[model samples]
Target: MDKNKFIKDNFGISDKTLKLVSEAEESIKEQFKHIENICEINQLRVMKAFADNRVSDSHFVATTGYGYDDLGRDTLDRVYADIMGAEDALVRHNFISGTHTISTALFAVLRPNDILVSITGKPYDTLEEVIGIQGEAGNGSLKDFGVKYVQIDLKHDGTPDLEQIKFTLTHMNVKAITIQRSKGYGWRPTYSAKDIGALIEFVKEISPETICIVDNCYGEFVETEEPTAYGADLIAGSLIKNPGGGLAPTGGYIAGKQKYVELCAYRLTSVGIGKEAGASLGFNRQMYQGLFMAPHVVSQALKAAVLCSAVFEKLGFEVDPKPNEIRHDIIQSIKFGDPDKVTAFCQGIQKGAPVDSFVTPEPWDMPGYSSQVIMAAGAFVQGASIELSADAPIKPPYIAYMQGGLTYESAKLGIMVAADKMLRKE
Candidate 1:
């Protein structure tokens, strides 16, 4: 009969769940308006960047060997820097992953005996090795490079302990302050651009010279404003995450102050080579087209996250940032007390995928984390979170973090299927 009726009949949704979905649908409509406003702003940004750079068909051509004077690559960096309100930007396929991009930024800024303070507490698990907090000897981590590391744990509610942060900044040779915009694998709130802006101001007040960096993965394009707008010295993220728009094959970006980005470029290639050296190869087309499509893709993913939160919360699962809550990032987490249910949830997501549907996912000791992790990502691009994926580290809370949906419809299907499968298991 109607759309709701069709969904209800086909998905075998319970009356209770349908009622919750009805409320969610209403809430989502209001949220859509907010996203629409953001999209408009972002659209203007993309159009302006293109117009300013005079992006042409020739700009999309691939380059090889040093990629010197690669107009497309240079313009792409300009567009990224323009959109992010940064002085400069370096977008390169050479920066392997989000972790690697962040590492390059950190290393570019911090020197031997300089103190690097993480005001957001311990960063994503993958960075521990990069920071020399973990990993084997002679890896030449930040710690190994003689840069001291310190962390100020967030309060229970995920707010940084300002007193601790101030104390840490004042007492040591705090050269840089890092604020992670995403929750990472933790069950904490993601920092909004506004939140990070305030933190930047606070740091500037404490030490005007100390540089501030934002680990910006999974948080871009979700907000109307970026951390760079509010004084962040550098913001780093993977192209495979939100910025890629499901098109970029492999890459990451670092954007912010010109001098800082210059240092990162130096670290990326060599001191003299800098940003001029990296070859775009053939990624120019995808990078250009993907960035233009990013705002729309990111909006779709955000809507999917809201839907996932609503659906799972209705099923009596603990959901982070309930569906109606203001979203700073695209991630939605559902806690399953039992690790079996966690695995089942992820498996259900994989089952619903358009790709790799026949394959099953299992929890294993994934390389970057302390706990065994199970991930369900049947993305067209490898590890692309801009498509539907559900993953979680097997731990006490056993929460599955789900993010990315290229389209609202695909994500709805995936979340509903996962809910159906998990409910059946229950």
Candidate 2:
């Protein structure tokens, strides 16, 4: 009762809303143990990587200018590679975003006339233009550069079409295949690390020369193992998403085979300046510290996601990864089925934010997406997905993809606040 009062008084949630949330949480408590188990395994792996890399205070030294021979920058790369179980990694605060990092990796692995296969069907919305599928010509996109691209749609059950993939491999001179481990903007279940590994193996058997790259975005550190552990040639992701633990202001990472990482490094910088020139700009410590805290923070976000599923399921809404289902990423997809409800839900999320509680969010044409979007995020770091935030395309079905929670407590309040606004309208 006292806890309910605290939530009601502080967050302005009605008692009815609180009761609903409380009931939702009680039903989902069993899911927390599984999340914690994965967290523990990943936490140990990260610690082991840090220790094996012999990290010291000197590795935190800031660098400027050409950033030549910067121990901090280079050692951090080694640490990241170790964490991902890859031969090498190019970790820098310089890579713009997850999409930017993935683009670089894609460009590095493929040349003109080489065919690129997306085994995971269409990628995230931002990558559409980057892949030259939905953008103007002569923009230096892959399509502009004469690189061919194809995709194999997942079956209705959300499983890969192995026969189609095998036939495609045999018929086409495929150079590389991209595996998006997370379900981006799609209602499909996120692929598990083991599941990804099986797919990589399947592809390798058919075409040993074809490189396999995993879009390791929101899926990072969620499972006990990364795709690299299962024989991925390369993996790319945004630091601000999961590995940052909500502390890294900005950046991205690409880790995998040494040759691919080295090529990506060349693309990130210049040919010869690869992995050697980027200045850490004093962000090394935050990166290091954030990574160390990632597992625990991810667990919190996972808990929040699970709770969202449980609450919305109880409310008779359609949700992917039904309550108590194992999560491969932090994202919780809730189908509200109405644009007005989507706006209200996001606005309520803003009100629950620590940074901008007074603001109301409205839908707008966000860059890199096809539809006008409504986003509810008031994070300390702009565009930081690891903090509590939600965004929806504001189109048919009106599904809201909510993710991130620095701490479970804050995320719970945010969910409660969003629920209050949603229920008030009903």
Off by over 4 Å in 1: 1-23
lDDT per residue for candidate 2 within 1-426, as digits (tens), equals: 588777778778998888899899889878999999999999999999999989999998998898888998898899989888899999888877999999999998789999999998889999999889998999889999899999899999888899999999999999999999888888787998899999999999999999999998999889988899999999999989999999888889999999999999999888987987988889999999999999999999999899888887877789988888888888999999999988888898888889888888999999999999989898988988889999999789899999998999998889989888878888
Lowest-scoring 10 consecutive residues by lDDT in candidate 1? Answer: 12-21
Off by over 4 Å in 2: none
Top model by lDDT, which number? 2
> Where does candidate 1 clash, by residue pair?
none
Looking at model 2, residue 370 earns an lDDT score of 96
Each prediction's RMSD over C-alphas, in Å, is 2.0, 1.1
lDDT of 2 at 315: 75
* Steric overlap count per candidate: 0, 0
Q: How close is candidate 1 to the true structure, as a TM-score?
A: 0.95
> Candidate 2: lDDT over CA atoms?
0.90
**Candidate 1 lDDT over residue span 1-426, tens digit each:** 587678668666555555655666676788777887887788778889889889999988888887899998888899899999999999998878999999999999999999998999989999999998889868888988898889899999889999998888788878998999999888899999998999999999989999999999999999877899999999999998898888989999999999999999999999998988777888999988889889999999998888888778878999898878899989998888889999888987887677897789998888978888999988898888889998998888888899998998878777777877766776
The lDDT of each candidate is 0.88, 0.90
Per-model TM-score, in order, reads: 0.95, 0.98
